[model samples]
Target chain A: MQLPVLNNTPSQAEHGAKGGCSASSCGTTDNQMDSLPDSIREKVQNHPCYSEDAHHYFARMHVAVAPACNIQCHYCNRKYDCANESRPGVVSELLTPDQAVKKTMAVAATIPQMTVLGIAGPGDPLANPERTFETFRRLSEEAPDIKLCVSTNGLALPDAVEELSKHNIDHVTITINTVDPEIGAKIYPWIFWNNKRIKGIKGAKILIEQQQKGLEMLIAKGILVKVNSVMIPGVNDQHLAEVSRVVKSKGAFLHNVMPLIAEAEHGTFYGVMGQRGPTPDELQDLQDSCSGDMNMMRHCRQCRADAVGLLGEDRGDEFTLDKIEEMDIDYQAAMEKRKVIHQAIQEEMDSKRLEKAVKAQQHQQEPKLTTRPVLMAVATSGQGVINVHFGHAKEFLIYEASPEGVRFISHRKADQYCGGDSTCGDGESVLQLTIRALAGCEAVLCSKVGYEPWEMLEAAGIAPNGEHAMEPIEDAVMAVYKEMAAAGKLDEKNEAVRANA
Target chain B: MAVSIIDLCVNCFACEPVCPSHAISEAKPHFMVDPKKCTECEGDFPVFQCASICPIEGAILDSFGVAINPPGSLTGIPPEKMAEAMAELQSH
Candidate 1:
């Protein structure tokens, strides 16, 4: 069987993912992070952050205080609505800063995980300083512990950079793909300031000017800056190296190279004439290329402003915007109440099972199918001379790539070395089995594992893969082998695990 | 047969004015990326400018199927230098 592509099993990759993607990088180069003052860089590396399924857990509020933006990009319109929140063909509900704050507090009382607060949206946050700062001030006084994060086009960030540093806000995401104004004109339609509409080349100029100034200011003030660049195939892809160059020079810490997702709903995607969206593979590949000096982001979930919880770990979108508003005041309390409901459901399931069993008893013609399977890890490596572990069995399996290719030669009867476990009992025997299995062939592809087994594998310079649902053994083995091959790690055919044992 | 555009466009316009082979047309409410003329931006820039500029994540996708860069994943000389100094690196 051929290896199914990544799209076939996304859940295995991203569902509360703790580790980084082995293949995709976050477009972060080395020079910027390495050159940073150890104090600052360490803060960044250790920063409690997650992507895709990983929620910031912190509740962030974007007071639509910055109701107006001076600059307009092709991808943006000062529409009374945002595409992320509204249904397609529908518009976002606009709220004043004061109204927004009231709603925020009311919502915060219910969610214990709400921690961060800031202004991020349609217009630049700093553009409307009075409303933006006022919202921040009120939130600070009200929820002091909550961290603040803001995303901006960086147009007016320069003027307010000092003010931002003064505020308790610690994290900032600036959208800057091209430092060159020539290309910038295509994305941004215009920039308005002092009652003047700066069009075309001039608008791009203003944007670049402000982005440079803003990024520098944040770095100087020691505020962690994360630069977000939209990966547009024809427009700025050619120039990302330039973007990477400038971003690194200015001392930016992280680069989020997000793929461009055009939608008629957002108004950001202007022309729908004949273009297509990027496949997942293309996005991962692009992320691998432009991720200069620092780590590349493989796991950008393109989260909503109000997105809640951790990646892969968040079982479902239960904390979604619609669900939260309709949920009970206390979320945990509500969840506990649901557990009660679940317990009731389990009792109902047990009753059904009992009924089915009784029916089978009455209709005795059908045979009862009771198969309590014993799971075993057979090592086909080498024969162990010392205990009954005998490692050679593990070696035999490594030579064959297929189950059809595998032929068991010997069967050993247990009841010999007994300490506890059945089949084979001795701890030494178990060790031999594990070591031999680890040596033969390559990785141990199984359903699930805990830290204990993972650690044992690591100690012996081994790796582990757990793709729970992919059926039979052949499919899983082939897929694992393909990925290993793609990553350039499949060793010689003769490599066996049990030989050392 | 005339090259036809499909219905999956999202108005990203990643294929506009970037027709090196000059095969693409203007976006329709969005635009269609011309693959034949794409040449994958072969002789021009370090990467495809259209794909880079399309901010609508995946709006301007890689039709040519060429692998591009991500953030901070450079293994060799730096990522930027890889493109600008492709010749130099290749010779080495």
Candidate 2:
């Protein structure tokens, strides 16, 4: 499939220099804009956080999709409504990728001004990689125009940056409080990586190194990087200038210095122990101090993980999960609607090529496989047609058949696999559960199945037959059984268990 | 009696903005209503402002283990009535 072009373009020095438009100067050259890759241009224009001017005209919505954090920061407590508030760990609703896509489409439709879709976190986005990337992949196809951005604490960024680039994620916000491990230790208590907890300065050092490495990798790929520093009073406040210098030298596009929200109510390790927050003047002074070559982002809202609407003005309440579910909105349809439109255009182009190829080959027909009978499972919507998707199929119809006839033996009920929502369960665990449910069956016949689950099922000795054919389930089952029998692979019981073994 | 905010509280600030005793404060999981200061709006208002203004039902609970603002409270359509209405609509 041809990649969709990113529509929004930023005419900034960062776009010129850091985006590989020009290496020598910050100013845009005559051919710089034209020479820039689609990913960088699209990200620069649509991401409100990166483009200061876009903040005024274009709105961005954050879906609190990632709900797990790999590291513990003294300032963070990842619950509450981070989408509506500016804090990192707070979010009103935690959505799975499916839910996030639905909500994003709904919000985007209702609010025409929304141009960017971001996953900022009630927790570190990369901490929950599966949910985070699945959302991105879905959104890339469903809402291609909406620029994608993700904010992480850099703990999991190293492992995730390459994947993020693959998804065409244009903007990344890495919260790097300080480069110094001694200072980082004061901010972050522990980091959970590779299934081990490294605490104190050691954890801080590892996190810092990873964050820097991740930042370099992202910039090398021409992905715009935004560094966010929470100006913690008496902690990393004095060292933010050095942070800006380091990140800027490493090709960070912008630096956002937000004041630390050290309220007594949060009972944060720092807050309870009377850690003070930087004053407005102190924050401004820090930003000003670092306001040299690196563009200083002075108007950060410190948005919540599930924040919606424009920057500074939060409209999260209007689109709460319950309210959205109640609305007569076909979110799945809305997501698919764009794809159908795009497919129509693609199909039209391919039709000519297909016709030419058919003319050249004279449309030679391939011979069918020999007839045999074997027991197999078939997923059908209704009327004995293989119509339903494998993941969404709730039940599989078991049939035992040969070349002569087929018999409906029984039906096995299985859980519907959902990818986006963590509440449903991880895709791997869910797929395993599904495979176990279909144990003893030689093969499963469905209209379509995802590649990942298909391979997994194949590994477990179950063949996934995805013909996506509009034929009677009996015919489909009989054909496969006949082929097995013809190959002399069917057992005495007319099943493929022995052949598969 | 003080009203307590459970984890279900979305932290929409509906409760915090309308609290009379200034008891509601943002917390880690959700907004917390201070039992020390919470009077359940006994003298402040006829209905608790936080509970009344909350969008999520059953998010705020009174000390008696009952939801001050139960589901259908935000929409003002009781669950039973809504179900009946839905049933009637589906029957058609």
Candidate 3:
């Protein structure tokens, strides 16, 4: 799943200039590639949907193993084979978890580019908890290298995310069309929850709350979350931008605005009742408008539950249930091997956590600096610390600090760095607005900052502290002051801030 | 199973009450027929009960991919007969 080198793309420089990406070569051989944290790189390296570069090279497959759904939506018709139609929840056959594992192994062996296995069903994966978890539990051990992905409607996600994390399911996609229950009612007809059926706006409201809660929980646990929004015309078409805003604020890695497929043939209520699918131009316009300060995935094929091979191409017919069942496979031996693999993965994760803990302890023991602290800014959603990414930051909370203490100064509104209209401006222009918002700050601390903004800030003599840690604002300010004091650069930073002010 | 709704279901719910096996139930996108509970309306009706009442043409297919309620199933007129009738009507 090796991606082509950045030098190969004619628009590589333009992409780097966009301000979100770092200007390093996209080649795996480069030193800059090595500098990326293993957690981040490994998550993106082989995952086709997550990594734009890898989507061309690597491939992913979805197993239609979950056959039960708790909610009813106007757009879905699970009875139809989702594979042939270009929408979610269409599978020719629904396999048991065991059968699913065998199919996955067979596909992996045949297709070298198949690096990801997703469980996006003809039904919500979370609704069929036992089957979905069983498939993940076996795959986590059997195909550890094949990144496990799941797409849910988020109705059952709040209860399922913790167990999903235990199975080491790193990537999760939640299809959230709208945040407004009034609008959601038009999309989702009813939901079965807590042994009762709730209908209309009430059910939609409950679903919205649960989805938001599940999103925040997943983000807090550091799971790579992607939101899939089906652009339902005359229902939530005008509302997806708000969906984009909310999900991006909650730290969704990508928002995929898919078009509604309301063909009359698919016994779906929407199709039967004459709900029209968005035109190509209408879909594009909605996506453009919803692009608010977040990355929007435009290449989604709206794949079926049993879709295989690359995003655009369908290779599902070759790996049918009948075909996989005929193969000479050693089921008993595979199970035995899975146990050993599970043990090894557990040991590796344990060692990594231990190493991280030791490094943090040592970092805390470093000496403090005596340099006077000038104004510093932090991007945070909560009032406490710098945990949000710079691109997602709507405002920056300013803080003033000295060797003695750190104090909250004021908050400044910052322009949305991503999303909204594409023609409003480019990333470089937005970076300038951000810099202007942080006027006299010596440095701005954030959980992450893109390459363009990093370079722009450096040129402006405003240090960009892009540390991927959720540290308290006071502690972060003090640590920076101590580091600057140790390097004999504290006075220099303070002078720059004063001169700029 | 009596009749299975493929992806072509329009979810009109016209066939739900007609199934005597009680296999058909409300489901996402359309309805589902539980294979274990289905008897294909053996004792309940002469024709496949669910398909007999289904409104959408070719919406219900049997295990052999033959539509239980194929096109013209509702009108009770074969395509050939319909063509002949149209020819007769034009002459009149």
Candidate 4:
């Protein structure tokens, strides 16, 4: 089936809207993919992590075959028994190359949506070169249809690039937290180089050089490189903009600035030291600041090393080595089934995009409602839907709705008010903090909200809305704006009365 | 004694406004019980308002931290069976 090209050009009305975004700066996946060459688009068209839209229809799985890391980061605590933790370095079970291939085949047979197989380890993939390459080599020959990718810490990346190019691996992710050695020293305590453990500034310097070199070499070899940076507050947060700039200039296809997961129970060095992760607001702001230079991936779920199923959900427990060994998978029939399912999904998505484009064009022809844009806050856990609960939201995506269209403004971080039952003693203060964080917004849209916050938000002049639960955030914001306009509550004269109401 | 909304509460907004003391306010992850203001429906109603309206089983606990609505009370689906059913559904 021929895929439909996305229509991302902004309508005239949208261009005339206040704080309007140009096609390039709109930050929608459609426009981002449209700008890329056909070659790169084909590579990321079905890879869930690489394209935001692909995640909705396609699923990806990771194999935890590589269990040796060359560098030690303060934030990393690679736990083998952590079944509940959903972070990077935690895997319930480790598999050998043969077991990994068997598991992948079983998953592919069961999950028709599985399109990409990645080797992002509980440790760096490149560090365990033989095991990683062996798994890749076998999979490439046996399951040649599945797109293969690898993620590394870049300590062994420069050395392994030539071997990596030999395999069918087209996508490579390097965790380049910072280009500056000073900030890198704070994150990486030591790196094993030249058969010795090197520590402090000197170790950081060598790691950064290798990462930059590895990134350049992969790009030169026509492989798409995605740079993953952990945003550690006060450590690398302020310096990540420079990292983004450097990576983008060096031809990194996408930059994913992920927040540092520093919960104290994780028992990492930073967590034990009481180092807090970046607030969602800070992470979004940094992402927005760097987005001007290149495409930023905002939909990363930070999957576990052995994560399975779709982006948000994990089904790894069902596909353990024992389970795979017991099951007989006819991969030929499974591939045929997958082809039919994928083609149907593509056709449905193409029609949906076409309908959306037509609606946008019609919206541009409509008469203007008002020149002033109403700002509203949306609670979302990604996928562009208002699907999060009010009290559960760590941050709210702010949107500006005017006569033109709804445009995303920025993210406002809120202190999570409800910490379940064990930590309700500080609820009142946290709610107050959350309210203070959303001072400027006129309404808060979420899937569900408790009554106390409903009253409190209304009292504070910000309307709490749960009616549009699970709706696309932009459509919901525009609906609220039109509701206000239809009620004559959007004019300057009714502002006071509207707030009081 | 205050009735606490545990992690099992789905933030369904069923118990918040029903609280006579208005002690069941919103919080991150789930709702809470404010110890200072909670009357537990004493001198107002015969039973705890929050516990009466809550939909999830074992979501509301008493002062002693024992669940007022224990498992299998509300949904009639046993916790073990519910887990099995949910896992079965998600596998597809």
Model 3's TM-score against the true structure: 0.53
Native-vs-model 2 lDDT?
Answer: 0.65
Scored by TM-score, the top model is: 4
- Model 1 residue A283 lDDT? 47
lDDT, residue A148, model 1: 68
Residue B36 of model 4: what lDDT? 91
lDDT of 1 by residue, B1-92 (tens): 11223433333233343335566575555466566566656666555554433323323445543233232121112344434443443453
Best model number under lDDT:
4
Q: Estimate each model's TM-score.
A: 0.48, 0.50, 0.53, 0.70
Cα lDDT tens digits, model 3, A1-501, are 122221233354335432332322211111222223466556764466654334444678999877666677778754465333556777787788999999998877666567789998767788778888999999888777677999999998999978988986888899899999999888876676554446689989999999998988888888878788898888888888778777876777567788887755565667656679876447656765564212224435577788888765568888888999888765455545544653554465345335433433343343434566677788875424478898888777666555434544444657632234333333446668778768778788999988988998888767889773587565687677566667776665455454443
- TM-score ranking, high to low: 4, 3, 2, 1
Among all candidates shown, the one with the greatest DockQ: 3
Q: What DockQ does predicted model 4 obtain? A: 0.01
Candidate 2, after superposition: displacement of residue B44 in Å? 58
lDDT of 2 by residue, A90-204 (tens): 7767787988988888887676667688887776788778888999999898777667888999987888878999985778989999999999888876676543446678989
Candidate 1 chain A TM is 0.55
Better of 1 and 3 by TM-score: 3
The list of candidate 1 runs beyond 4 A from truth reads A1-38, A41-63, A80-91, A106-108, A269-277, A292-296, A305-501, B1-92
**By DockQ thresholds, what CAPRI class is model 3?**
incorrect
Q: CA shift at A362, candidate 2, in angstroms?
A: 72
Going through the candidates in order, what is the number of backbone clashes in each? Answer: 107, 17, 17, 5
